[model samples]
Target: MILVSGCTGSLGDTRTNDSTDDPTTGNPTTGNPTTVDPRACEDGTVRPGRAPLRRLTRFEYNNTVRDLFGDTTDPAFSLPSEDVGNGFGNDADTLSVSSLLAEQLSTVAEGVAQRATATPDALARLAPCASNVSPEGEEACARTIVERIAPLAYRRPLAAGEADELLALYSVGRTDASFDVGIATVIEALLQSPDFLYRVEWGTSDPEHPELRRPTGDEMATRLSYLFWGTTPDEELRMAAQAGELSTKEGVRAQAERMLEDPRARKTIRFFFDNLLPISNLADLERNAEAFPTFSRQIGALMREETQRFLEHEIFEGTGTWASVLTAPYSFMNGPLAAFYGVSGVTGDEFQQVQLDTTQRLGLLTQAGLMAGTTHSNNTNPVVRGSFVLQKLMCQKIPLPMGDILERVKPPDPYSGATARERYSQHSQDEVCRTCHQYLDPVGFTFENYDAVGLFRTTENDVTIDASGSLPGTPGTVSNATELVQKLAESEEVHDCFATRWAEYGYGLTLRGEDTCTKQAITTAFKASGYNVKQLLIELTQTDAFHYISVASQE
Candidate 1:
């Protein structure tokens, strides 16, 4: 996780001006010490840093199989659950292969092979010469099919020996059964290959920098497609790789621009936010229906869709800036969601765009889905809600509450005359609780106007709600959700935190001290571009961190 310490400062400052700096590390003068250029530490030196071999996440596997064989069965759904790292399941470090998973892969591969060759026409499409009467013609057709499909499945051109080995498998199946069986056998083998299961990336030494290395064109294509599309490269992208179009920054940008315009890019954008805000958990969210009569499993599904639609409109249809997303005063809602928000004029199942009352709602923080998802089933929990803002939005590391404190911080009593705020005020009275809640409770208190299920409420037990709080190091205090969101929108710390999250998501690694310079360059460009998300993505693709690798020795 990236930890932000202190107030926002100049990200681009690469000079040391401390007088106590050692002679070997600072300026080499005796009389008066001057600022030393930090870039002199071999800045921009490309090296082949560590790139872990990653297995395809469940989503990636399902999507790639869908694209490859047009199978919509979602085979990976039956596989073992993946361990999440760096806030995403796709992180290479956590995707381990277990014995059960290996067995399931073989079963899935066979099932997919049967589905792909279910009909004569489907088999014909896959292997054109399968209908040929002569054995010689059938063998020739099998070779052609292997040669054509293996590269796409492997994501690189297959070696001659590899192709021969696959051909040998087909020949064995043909002698035992028939031509179609031979084709299905080949498909099963290819699907089970490591080349199909894992994304393999390694770097070759760069001539200009002997110690550094760069990804080959094919490897670059795979990286770009997975980063932007969350699946394998299409035929067009594969052609570009084979033609060496991914070898330069300009070439990569052209492909990225084209891919962004495609509909598939929407999937990647949604995937990022789904994990970031984590709407996926809402699908299975359980609530006390007896207490909150209107809430149900169906309402939870609608809530997820509402957030996705709102995000899509803001990101793609509107200006696509961080400011627009944070302060947008509108949301897309269907009958179920509209009823929950107490908004009128929207009926039926389809989500319609509704203008929000700025006094009541502002951006994602006020959205019913997020607000409801963050709270408990029966009542609101200030610590959970406040900790989310501090850690995820602001990138501050708040230590988890210990066992003793967790035992003491009891839930607020709803039937009591005390309001939610009054009931939870014990934190300020205890030393152990006050240490963290001093920073958390205030931020969470701003959302008290929304109940456990995110319905607007003015009072609890007939007592007025106090949605007032102060953000540490920020000027003034906010009294409501809208003011808090507006303050966050104007904060440089929030902007840098957002940028840091994107870097972690895009690069698939935790940001370390060595990455500060690269992150600074990206954040500087992000600010210069008015925080346009699309432009920020384009800028990230061109950074040295994306295009070149650092030497392992340096790492």
Candidate 2:
């Protein structure tokens, strides 16, 4: 149960061990560190704070097994869903293994190992030596396989003792079954090993600064593969690590650039957007059936696909900038989704690029999946929509209303007025409620032209929709969703927040004061690049936060 430094950080500036909240005060209390290293970040160098041990998410695990043993069965789905801490499922702090998860892991590992060693072709792909050798050579062949596969599985070279442990497991299997079964036994052990399950990095020492430690080349290779490919590193990347190419920032950037061009990088990019945006489970999204007769689960699924395709196209195929993501006057849609949106002539399941009518829609903000996912089943909620844009895009924290305040300030009924603006006007009218809603309602009101299901509307209850609202930092009010996204595309706050989110996703750290300098440098570079998403990803690899680590103890 050895924990890393900063493993239980408080919601404060100081590093402390007491992460529990005080019952009376409702504020976290800090405690002195159980152990401290005298050599700490001193000269204002960018502090690469320690991250907790990371277990692979279901997505990562499935991708890894696919690349590792050519098993595309997606065995990891049997495990529990990950806790989405700090806006991402991959956040390390909340990835601890539960007793249920531990039981599920054993079942999953057994199933994957059985499939991997089932056929002769699979056995040969894993270890040719297993079949080529005679009866006496079976044990030797097993050793050869373990030596070769264990490093790839652990993502680092195994110590002599670790190798012996795997060989011992092989012996137990050999005693019970055939050689292939023995190999299966070894595979089961490898899959369930802590070395295979958790990314445990006890970094190598730094001669230049004894206080700071850095990830070994192999560890860096693991980071690069998971961040870019969302899977295990290929042979070329492993060789680069073995050759000491990942020790320098330039070398890391070169590898990252090459990895980004691979097809697997497309999946990684889509995965990030899936977590960051509101389109994760659109197929199961609820909607008022009678209000929209044509809306089906299939259509909801198409809505999610449209958003994913739009993101992949903009970041990779289009201009590859934040501005393009927010203000592009085009989207990808299939015949079904097109028909759902009332656009004609699109005729199949495959998605194609379609020019949007710029007057009513622009970029991701106007995407149906996002709009529908954030609103209610029967009516649009301005408070929910506005809070998402503010907290996610603007990085503004909205404190919860105290006690019975939320009960007293319930959302206005949709039938209370002819238009959504009139119905939600109490948010601005009430002095107590206006204090918090003022920051949210303005930005949310601009999307009033879109109904609960995100279809464009000119009127509600025979009243013309008035979608005019102002943002806190923008120069003036916007006329509609299109104009609002345009203003957001030009916002420095939006750019900075986008950069911060990427850093958090890439490094798997909840950024703090220790990461301030590092975060600032990344945002500065992102702005300089005109908010190019690809360039920001490369810039993430070149920072101290990606290359170094702070160990909690000598272990």
Candidate 3:
């Protein structure tokens, strides 16, 4: 329910609950806060603002790929590695623009456009104009292309001359050897344009005052699509945009729900899972070969896939509560993973969750990905695992330790070694380190029974592992990975944190102090939908903040 910075926001002062700070209408003040409302503490909204204009995050590049193309290609491979501020990669303001990224984008765009033109699934949905194609026909061709892809590319249609200019580029491209090349060039240009890369907040024209501008319906649909589906608007959605059905809250809600029902809507949920469990590049993960002999590169990856299948089942196919995800008795596994997890009924490439015989295999906390990511090449870092829980799931930040983690990498004496907790406590003997590590290492020690590659282990350094730990911000102990997941599933903070993350995604940037109304609305959505990820998305995009932009930002 509370923000991680708690009171130490990177920006300015925060009023916990200011009546004037409507999350929907915004802070009634966009700039810095003046006098703090006395009512802020009781009902103060933690409205998060933009960190600063940074560069496009890796996830944004991936989402853009999935949206522009189908969910087939993965172009983030060639993109620049992200510079993370807080935890998220896509904090605009913190994001930056560079020649290197632009070059990469150019190449990616060419590849994506070529694939879009040729691929069956993608070409089937292409909106290219068969009516005209030439340097002479550039205007008509551009007009048709702009009309169809514009709503998606710019998140709104272009103005009268906008298509004309793009057509001019197409005319230039006509000098190229092929029509497909020209079209691909245009699509490539659109992807690189500031219009596509950034959240272009274009206001629509006022009917009463012809000179006034405000966002039109197509713009609203673009906002809804990116917010809910993490993609460009499909044809039906584009039709609604052209027809002016996305301007009102009711219309946005209807469209959002419809998108959720659409097969593509799952992209948003999948994105959330990907971010939460950064599995996009499993091919790169490494484990200590000798200690984790069973953890081949393939097994390292199988764990992530199992988690995905498990989540897909929980979110889309079966019960949709956070509880079911953690406490559910079932899990999916390919042959290797099933053998590792010691479960049956699961065969080859296909995965299906068969009930496990033991209660220890609760949820994500017990999962191998969570385990491996938290450990080092040959050892488990309880601090990393525990800190992840505190910072990510609980919305409580364990202050970053002052220096590099203790460089002591030697394997401990197993025959005489204490539990993982005892080994971890050695570094915290210093005063400065104890401050934060105390909070994290204790919680992380619970998964010590799982080794570097997440394979269950009876002993570490020849000593039996101890998988017992306690939660800092909660009641009861997480005796092991099983109870840890149960504790997280029941925690309101986890759900609230996830919902807030979704709100941030929906708005296409971080929700600012002015945006309490949206988070409040999101909270209502979580409660009403019984914490369904799909349902909360509809409620979020239905709000004015999802589409409405102030007049000046449009410029």
Best by lDDT: 2
**Model 3 misplacement above 4 A:** 1-76, 85-88, 110-152, 175-185, 205-215, 403-416, 550-555
C-alpha positional error of residue 171 in candidate 2 after TM-score superposition, expressed in Å: 1.3
Per-residue lDDT, model 2, residue 159, is: 89
Q: Model-by-model lDDT, in order?
A: 0.74, 0.79, 0.62
Model 1: per-residue Cα lDDT at residue 175: 83
RMSD of each: 6.8, 6.3, 6.4
Question: C-alpha displacement of 452 in model 3, angstroms?
Answer: 1.6
* Superposed model 2: Cα runs more than 4 Å off: 1-44, 131-134, 427-429, 552-555
Kindly report the root-mean-square deviation of model 3 from the true structure over all alpha carbons.
6.4
Ranking by lDDT: 2, 1, 3
C-alpha-based local distance difference test score of model 1: 0.74
TM-score, each model? 0.88, 0.90, 0.80
Candidate 1 — which residues are off by over 4 angstroms?
1-44, 47-50, 131-136, 402-406, 409-417, 551-555
Superpose all Cα atoms of candidate 1 onto the true structure and report the RMSD in Å to 1 decimal.
6.8
Q: For model 3, how does the per-residue alpha-carbon lDDT over 1-555 read when each residue is reduced to its tens digit?
A: 212221111111111211233323323344536323324523633322222222345565566667655646677667876544333455553467688877888888888878765543453454444323445654565557656665467766567788777776666775745655555667778888887777655456556544434456766666666665665567788788777786667877787778777766665667677666545445467866675566677876787777787888887887877667767777778788877766666677777667754456666667777677655456666766776676566555333322233333222443333666776566556555555655666678877878777777777667777777877767667667777777788777788767876666555455545555556667667977888866777777655455445443333
TM-score of 3: 0.80
State in Å the error of residue 524, model 1: 2.2
Clashes of each: 3, 0, 36
